[model samples]
Target: HVVDELALLSANIVEVVHDRLSSNVRAGTTGVTLSLETEDQKHMDKLIQHLKEKSIDFKVLT
Candidate 1:
C-alpha cells in the first residue's frame, strides 16, 4: 500500500514537472534545465529508488 502511494505521488510530481517544462519550452526558455532539489534529498532519493524498483523510467533533466 505504501509503495502504491509512493508510485502515485511520484507520477503526479513528474506530471507536474513535465507540464511546467512544457510551458517553459513554449515560452522560448531555450536550454533550460530541470532538477529536483530539496532540503530532504533523502526523500527524493527514496522516491527515485522506489520508481526504479517499480520499473518506471524517469528522465532527470538538468
Candidate 2:
C-alpha cells in the first residue's frame, strides 16, 4: 500500500527502493527504508511535502 502510494506520487521520482538493514543479526533487520530519488528541486519539494502530509520520518541526503 505504502509503496503504491509512493509510486503514485506526482513527483519527478527517478527511482524508489525498499531497503532493509542487515547487521550482524541482519544489516537491515531494524526495518524497511524507502529510498526515493528525484531529479530536481521541485520534485524534492513535492516528495518532502508528501512525506510530511503522511507523517513519515525522512531525511534529505543531498
Candidate 3:
C-alpha cells in the first residue's frame, strides 16, 4: 500500500526511465523497487520528502 501511495504521489512528476525492470516478479510481491530519473533536483527533493512523510526507509544515490 505504501508503494502504491508513493507511485501516486510521484505521478506525472518525474521521468520513468524504466518501469517494472523484472518480468519474473509475481503478483502481490511485497518487495519491489521504485526508481525515478530526472535532471530536476526538485523531483528528488519531493521524493525524499514523500518518503520521510510516509516514514519509509530509503536510500538516495546521486
Candidate 4:
C-alpha cells in the first residue's frame, strides 16, 4: 500500500523490509503485504489503471 502512495511518490527506495505479526493461521499470514517502487512510468500507468478499477489484486514486475 506504501501508505497510500506516499503523497504521489518521489521515491528511489531500496530494500526496506518489515516484520510484525499475529494471527498466523498456519502461516498464511493473514492480511496486507506490499512492496512498491516508483521512478515513474507515467505514474506506473496510473497506478495500473487504479488497480484495475479497484478489483485490487496486483503484480507487475518490471
Best by TM-score: 2
Note the Cα lDDT for every prediction shown: 0.52, 0.61, 0.59, 0.57
Candidate No. with top lDDT = 2
TM-score of each: 0.41, 0.51, 0.48, 0.29
* All candidates in order of lDDT, best leading: 2, 3, 4, 1
How many clashes show up in model 3? 0
Please, what are the lDDT tens digits per residue for candidate 2 over residues 1-62?
55555666744345555445445235634444445666668877887788788887556665
- For residues 1-62, what per-residue lDDT tens digits would candidate 3 score against the true structure? 55575666653334333334466555554434455564478866876788788888656755
Give candidate 2 misplaced runs (Cα > 4 Å): 10-35
* Poorest stretch of ten by lDDT in candidate 3: 11-20
Candidate 1 stretches with Cα past 4 Å from truth are 1-39
**Residue-wise C-alpha lDDT for candidate 4, range 1-62, written one tens digit per residue:** 54454334454444444444655433644444455677668976777777677676656665
Indicate whether candidate 1 or candidate 3 has the larger lDDT: 3
In candidate 4, how many Å is residue 9 off? Answer: 16
How does model 1 score by TM-score?
Answer: 0.41
> Rank by TM-score, descending?
2, 3, 1, 4
What overall lDDT, based on C-alpha atoms, would model 2 receive against the true structure? 0.61
- What would you estimate as the lDDT of candidate 3? 0.59
lDDT for position 40 in model 1: 69
**Each candidate's root-mean-square deviation in Å?**
8.0, 4.2, 5.6, 9.2
RMSD of 3: 5.6
